[model samples]
Target: MSDLIFYTNPMSRGRVARWMLEEVGAPYETVVLDYGTTMKGPDYLAINPMGKVPAIVHNGRAVTEGAAIVAYLAEAFPEAGLAPTAAERANYYRWMFFAAGPLEAVTADKALGVAPTADQQRMVGYGSLDHVVDALEGAVKANPYIAGDRFTAADVFVGSHIAWGMQFGTLPQRDAFDAYVARIMGREAAARAREIDDALMPQPVS
Candidate 1:
């Protein structure tokens, strides 16, 4: 058995971690857990108390959260060169957390029809979905990649959010976002990851 084990459901945010795993090109054992079943079972919940997919267990050490998983794999397998350089570290962390925190918060709020009133904007971390979207657009527009000129683990987390946002109508489609998605999602590793998840998706009953 591979020392690295990935627990995921193809339809979940686990796709982001899967992409990072492919980018690292490391061998990992995949355990597909269905929603509300194995995912919430005692055994899996022990690995991730939140009962979330996209967790990884490496050498018996469990790392949960999609963003952390991406970052962890990048460092764990340095040969892949996915970790940010010293120069790129600032933006690397900045954007990755931005997506995980504000961007994700606002998008989920929007999806659930929970828009905050203007007076409550300050109370919420993201303020508003439009505000988060504008900030994200500027970030991606400023750099070819999230960290800098080269792709890093940050892109796996941030880029996946952007792609998912656009596809699900959580984020507005703009030229900058479109171009940025084209640039990063075009990666061979991204394609491979998508193929893997796509194949795993439940087939429509004919």
Candidate 2:
């Protein structure tokens, strides 16, 4: 029996988990869910009560959140070499959650044009989008990967955010982000993941 069951919607954040799965090089089944019905149904909600995409079940256990799934897959499939070393794990975790938390929230806020002001920033977790973007640029520019020279699950999580940020124009263009994304896009595994998800996505009505 297959131990890993991946549940996703091609148009959603599940794309991030899919890329990590490809990097893991593991066999898994994909269960596609819909936004209106299937995803909010009781069965799917059992896996993630939040009714969110990008949930994975492995060894009879379910994991939700794209970042969590990516991190879990790295440990679950150690042979993929996607897990960070002990010494580099701190940085790996720091930047990984940074993307999942601050980067994610700030970008959305920026896109919505409701970002918190400088004084209000302290109360919010992201502390403003500009600070978040500047910090991320520095991190990517200084290190080839979030954890160091090695491409760990951190890259899969954090890197995907950068890719989407740049593509959607939510984040400003930066030489560092561009170079980092170029390197990640060069991987065949990344290519395969993109192909699979793109194929599954529904065509726009317009």
Lowest lDDT 10-residue stretch of candidate 2: 109-118
Give the top-scoring candidate (TM-score). Answer: 1
Please list the residue runs of candidate 1 whose C-alpha ends up more than 4 Å from where it truly belongs after superposition.
none
Please give the CA lDDT of all the candidate structures.
Answer: 0.95, 0.90
TM-score of each model, in listed order: 0.98, 0.96
lDDT tens per residue, model 2, 1-206: 57999999999999999999999998999999999999999999999999999899999999998888998999888999888898888999999999989999988988888867778998889887778999998899877888898788898889899999999999999999999999887788889999999999898899
Instruction: Give the number of the best model, judged by lDDT.
Output: 1
lDDT of 1: 0.95
Predicted candidate 1 versus true structure: per-residue lDDT over 1-206, tens digit per residue: 77999999999999999999999998999999999799999999999999988899999999999889999999999999999999999999999999999999999998999989999999998998889999999999998999999999999999999999999999999999999999999899999999999999999999
Q: Where does the lowest 10-residue lDDT sum fall in candidate 1?
A: 125-134
Q: What is the lDDT of candidate 2?
A: 0.90
The true-versus-predicted C-alpha distance at residue 81 of model 1, in Å, is 0.6
